[model samples]
Target: MTTTALGIREYKRGLTDLGNGAYAWLQPDGGWGWSNAGLVVDGDESLLVDTLFDKYLTAEMLGAMQRAEPAAAEIGWLVNTHSNGDHCNGNELVTGAEIVASKACAEEMAHESPAMMAKLMAHAPEMGEVGEFFLHCFGNFAFEGIEQRPPTRTFEGAFDIRVGDKDVHLQQVGPAHTAGDVLAWVPSERLVYTGDILFIEGHPILWAGPVQNWIDACDYIEGLDPALVVPGHGPITDLRGVRAVRDYLVYIRDEARKRYDAGMPVLEAARDISLADYDSWGDAERIAVNTSVLYKEFAGDHGPNDTQALFAMMAQLHKERRG
Candidate 1:
């Protein structure tokens, strides 16, 4: 039992049983709250996907999973879909779980940890509104006690693991949202847990890729036609969910290309593109970052990704939002 601002009550993790001992967890409510994790469990063994932000929230997520399956006693595997802290932090809460993620994701995971985020935020909480939102959004969520345990195994392209009777497939589906993004496909359940590949209701941010890579990723996912698609953020969806993201990417790509041709500035292009389908997503202001990456892809921005530059572009977008 935990005490929330609302009141004290037993922690309830997220959406319950889908089938075949599979369950989905909707993290919490702020923004990182938008991120989700999953459980593939059987009687005695299980696998988990993408732990939440802090130790407390991750513990809550695990506690809920145990309630749903009780197999946390012996979770066979833990697969991280990407390098984002929201997806992989708080891993210390799960005892004896063999962690797994893409090689790229693993490498990136090492670059940042819960402790690191805590430290950075402690010093410059206002580095950017995104960082502030991260702090504010996750402020109530407990990460204070969590240990950062990254994956034990790393695969390059594809890998498969069996938990009791179910098979979990991990596919390296990145250079789209990040350098290395992976998706977990439970063959028997017809479900694909897309880390950041499918944001469902949220705007898709491109951190690493040629834009087309992510577009192709959406196409591959569409071709699979999975019955249940669990996004890194947002509720559970399906093939239609995947197509919606593909459409958004295609539209943005075309829109960005036109701006590139028309010689509009990156920030201007981000504001002008008009992402109608994704206006409902949180952080729609991220369009500037997307435009920056895509603009560089086409017109060539030779400078390395400056942290300052990224935030400036987003700050401009956030500023634009106020007007």
Candidate 2:
């Protein structure tokens, strides 16, 4: 019997063509180090939404695109939705493409080189909890020889570019997922590629947040009402997926705020608040990161995040969740 006849729709990996010269490249389970990207083709001109985690993955995605649509062989422009390595590390593979990113993303990209990740992984063996957590989250990707190539062009606020005759609109929607996040909208196709802004089946890590900005970003997506929404991670979804993530952020914000008001410690509050509906989501340990950040926001603290402490907390949380 065919796979579909067996009531199983094979979770195929690779591009899903969205009519009107658009495609979404999906990596299933959308777990750690995995991300989704897109291609917009118009005549012979093509634009890539984002690249994969490392060189090999990006090359693989590009190869698939080339086979499916030759226009992908010559990507004229590459837009990185954010600065996260998972989204931009494969940038060098595109060759001569005028890579573009929001100003904030480009700035963040400067310091978050692939070498940084490699160094961390190298030292993970000696750091106990920190090392274990680091490897757990990022050990899968190969980071060698990744000469980080940041966006050559940068834009602030909203920008639009043309792929052949079609117009692709870009909106800077961050300091939500990170310092610089963006959304790529193909108006003609009513398709939106939201970088880390939306994580469908997994928990989102707010590495940087005022929390409110992310919540607002969600509202912005709802306003667009795109017919097909492709998340930075996860399967293609619609407005409902956008709302799901928004609701989650709101839930954690409100819950953590209540605990903050009661003078509960951030760590305790993180462990205390029940994920309730979200317990089923992958990477639930991310709640530790989310709650601490929300608590910081609630207290009016705008200082740089304590990355080590947050990961330590997450490590502890991971243990608790697993135990």
Q: Write the per-residue lDDT of candidate 1 for residues 1-323, one digit (tens) a residue.
A: 11133221112346556767877787433244458888888668888888877766677777777777767756778888998888877777777878898888888777766666566566556666666544544465554545778889999989999888778888887878888999898878788888888886678888776788898888887777677777888767778778888988888889999999999988889989886756667777678888888888886664446655776677667666767
- TM-score to true structure, per model: 0.89, 0.95
Error of 2 at 161 (Å): 0.9
Local distance difference test values of all predictions, in order: 0.76, 0.88
Q: Total clashing residue pairs per candidate?
A: 2, 0
- What is candidate 2's TM-score against the reference? 0.95
Error of 2 at 86 (Å): 0.2
**Candidate 2 lDDT trough over 10 residues, lowest sum:** 1-10
